[model samples]
Target: MRLGYELKEAAKISWVAINSNRLRAALTTLGIVIGVATVSLMGSAIAGLTQTFEDSLSLLGTDVLFVQKFNWATGGGDWREMRNRRDITLRDAKRLERELSMAQAVSVEAQSNGLVSYEERSASSAAIVGANENTAMVRGFLLADGRYFSEADVDGLRPVCILGSSLAENLFPRFSPLGERIKIRGKKYEVIGVLEKLGGFLFGDVDNQVMVPITRFVSDFAYNPDVNISVKAVNTELLDDTRIEVRGIMRKIRRLGPGDKDDFAVNQQDMLMDAFMQTGGTIAAGGLLITGLSLLVGGIGIMNIMFVSVIERTKEIGLRKALGAKRRTILIQFLLEASFICLFGGLLGLGIAYPITLLMQQVFPATLAWPVVLTALLVSIFTGVISGYLPAFRASKLNPVDALRQD
Candidate 1:
């Protein structure tokens, strides 16, 4: 009871001292306040960026794999290597679809650049994608109006099209695009579906393109024989097994000899995620390093202020030591004073940062999670300990006779 009482008395004295020099104490805490706010904001921004990337990539589907002539992330960053590999074609996509039992769905895809026109309005150099009926399922495309292409449309080589959300809006802002005939390179194609808005991807825009039947694309642009194949696993648990089965089926279809190496790449979402994480990590590390320097400066400032406070309170400390006060009491009082200052500053920082985080939600999702808040408080307490220890020790060890002799 006595120890507790002494500790409470010490805290009261420290609080009183802080109130006596309110402006000086507030100025002393400014460094800590700025440091905490900056670090918290940086952490939240990085998390927001990560969330945005994942949401954008969700259009690719987590369980789907892309079989192509080259890997987009790796492969020595050489185009010649990709070019020298055998071209993946629509036929390969068909063969894979027919032979692979592990795959729930497969689609053939190819791209070209063309101008889409609707009477007075036109978008030049628009992305043109060629796909079969399965493309809608494999690529996670949703329609805002009308329906996706049917099997009959693919078989008969119908000049049917689906406009991306932005494309539809640009071409037919005032009216619906369903059943409307649009021209692509002087060739007429009827808009059968207008895809729902998919925002954008870092790799490409998902809402500024058009999809047509594979046959229609082959007829219009025959120069590019390269086709990409997308395969979706039956379920999440079967992804690995499905990849293995796909590799075997693909190897047999390509007629590679027993000794020959595979020329194609089997890509899953993990590959893209891995690449993204590597880049994200470097950026996050750089940002944290800069912010860490700010924290170090703050810690230094706290240490400087605590030393000054000890010097100013030398006589009071001497008077207490001459009485019944122990060395531990003096140490605890100084430590509590420093801790209270930092804790107060940290809470103030959080208050200021809350509004900024809410505003950031407009650009990206910056949530002030409980874990981050708790961590900031814990970090404030730790900073107090590290910065206040030396000063607290010096005050505790002061000789009563020498301290009383000081002015």
Candidate 2:
């Protein structure tokens, strides 16, 4: 028989065999169905989580750097020793600003929690952030209405505030927040601007905060407290050079000698990204462990069903061999049977997983991707081939006389 004719015949025969024992075929496919669904759903969830994190990262801006007293990673560190390190102060920020020319904008930040109130409206838990005038450039926050505080505003200790979008909505839902007065810690401050909505809180949401000048914050809150400095580079391409210069300047400002180990950390977006990657790797590893076991069980089920199939069709195998069928043709036919079973199972699994992925999106950010579908399909086929090999080989090697006499 020609190759195409043989393949067509094999498919028709497999289909008829599956239909003849539909209950058995369906039961055999359960393992594959569960395995594919678990793996594809895990993959889709991780993809969505990564994208959500990236969106949050975008608001921080890759070109900006944060200079602080503590390293984000804090690897192999003694907590007491870290606590003993001097706090990063406003004076350090000033010194760095005076010395570092590569920096486009350098601003110091401090924050406190307080109730934000406007007349009858109030948000009890709100971050009252204290930062310098160039916050817009450094933090990458855009204005929804009005304008950010100016250089003169910081120097003058003006009682002006910028509301984060969510905070604005809470405090002034019916009217515009611009030119409105809100009380923070019993002090009335004029609202100058409201920030555009930022992505969800992976690193604390900016949308639930209020921004004010660092000078006003210190006067009203605490003086000489630890503060974080944000430095924006003049050009993103020269960010590394800018970081190097700023690091040296910060060390000098902190009075750390060349021989002495630095007390403070110079942080960038990539450091946080590394942390995210580590988290992603850990989740993936756990998912793979669970999914692998499920798939292994499924493969064994497929192998067991294939062996049973070969035994049940002993007479059929003998008849095919007696009618001048080659061993290769017999092998191909049985292999195709196993492959089609897995392929169908994979498709059914995808159908089950699609709605699950959609439901997951409603609770968290997640979606099924085409690549994940393709991977499940390929994995199923590969699994079928591996599992069916022994059974197909035994079927092909059976002698016509022995197989015919078995029944």
Candidate 3:
């Protein structure tokens, strides 16, 4: 009951401090507000980016594993060395398919960036992927209209194509791309199908491209001396078996003997996620370092304000002490006042941060995870206790006779 009464008294004193030094309190808390706001906003943005990448990868199917000449979307290591590596060709893909009974399906792809044209409309710098019929199943591509290229078309090297949703919309705005003739690299090809909209990959939208037979691609553009082969496991449960089988097959195909390091890379969803996480950790560390400075300045400001409050309230402290107030009471009151200021500042910062985060989400469709919010709140409260300690101690140790003697 005495603690409750003391708390009420401390609350009343904190209210007095706030009401008396409104402008000074605002100025003092500004650093804290900015620090909290910055940390919260940056965390939310990073989380949103992480979620976007995860969503894009999830769409690509976690069961699929890519066999590539080099790491396709991760870790920058000796690109020149990777570039000099040999290509994985259609034959390699065929060999893998034939040897690996555990493999569900296999596809080979080559890509060129070029202009796609349909009469008056043309899309410049569009992605043109050369793939076989198995690409539809492996990449989870769905047909919006008409049909995907058949195995016969791929084998015959027929001049046929499927338009991604964006490419179709761009090249054939007035009518459907299916059954229409589109020119790619000066060669006219029939659009056999239009692919449904599959939103952005980590690189960008899969729907903003065109796909043709791997044979036709090789015949027209030829392999750039370096092409990647993508392999999908039949079932996720067989992932380990598939990996072992693929390693054996690729080793035989590449003619690498025992004790030789594999020249090629096997890329998977976890590899991409790990790469992104490492990058995100670096960015978050940098952000925290910058924001830590701001929080330090805020802490200093809190200490300064409390010191000033102690000096200014010397007469009040003397009178309270003369009237039977204890040193502990004095300590608790000043500390509570400082803590109140920090808590208020933190709440205010959150008010600003949350709305900004919501605005970003509305504008960019980004995800803001709850953990980020909770973390920011906790950090703010922690700042209050740590920053207020020294001044609270100073206030408690004041000599009542000396305080009363001061003007």
RMSD of each: 2.7, 2.1, 2.3
- Window of ten residues with lowest summed lDDT in model 2: 70-79
Model 1 clashing residue pairs (backbone): none
TM-score to true structure, per model:
0.90, 0.93, 0.92
Off by over 4 Å in 1: 1-3, 72-83, 120-125, 200-204
Give me the candidate number with maximum lDDT: 2
lDDT of each: 0.86, 0.87, 0.81
Candidate 3 lDDT over 1-407, as tens digits, reads 99999989988987897888899889878877887787778778877777778888787677887888787566544788777778877787778878877778887788888988998889888898999889999888899999987889999999999998988888877877778898998889999999988775464647888898989998887754255666789888777778888888999999998998777777777777788788877987898778767767887888888788778888888888888889888878877777777777877777888889889987564544678767766776677777777877877777888878888
Best candidate according to TM-score: 2
Off by more than 4 A, model 3: 72-79, 223-225, 362-365
How well is each residue in 1-407 modelled by candidate 2, as lDDT tens digits?
58899899988988888889998889889999998899889888877888888888887888898888777663725667778999888888888888989988988899788888999889898998998888887888889999999999999999999999999998988899899889998889999999998856485559889999999999987787689999999878989999899889887887888898878888888787787788777987798678868877888999999999999999999999999888988998888888888888888888899999999988888878888889988998888888988999999999999999987
**What range of 10 consecutive residues in model 1 has the weakest lDDT sum?**
72-81
Tens digits of per-residue lDDT for model 1 on 213-271? 99989998665569989999998799899999889988998999899777787888777
How many clashing pairs per prediction, in order?
0, 0, 0
Candidate with more favorable, higher TM-score: 2 or 3: 2
RMSD of 2: 2.1
Candidate 1 Cα lDDT to native: 0.86
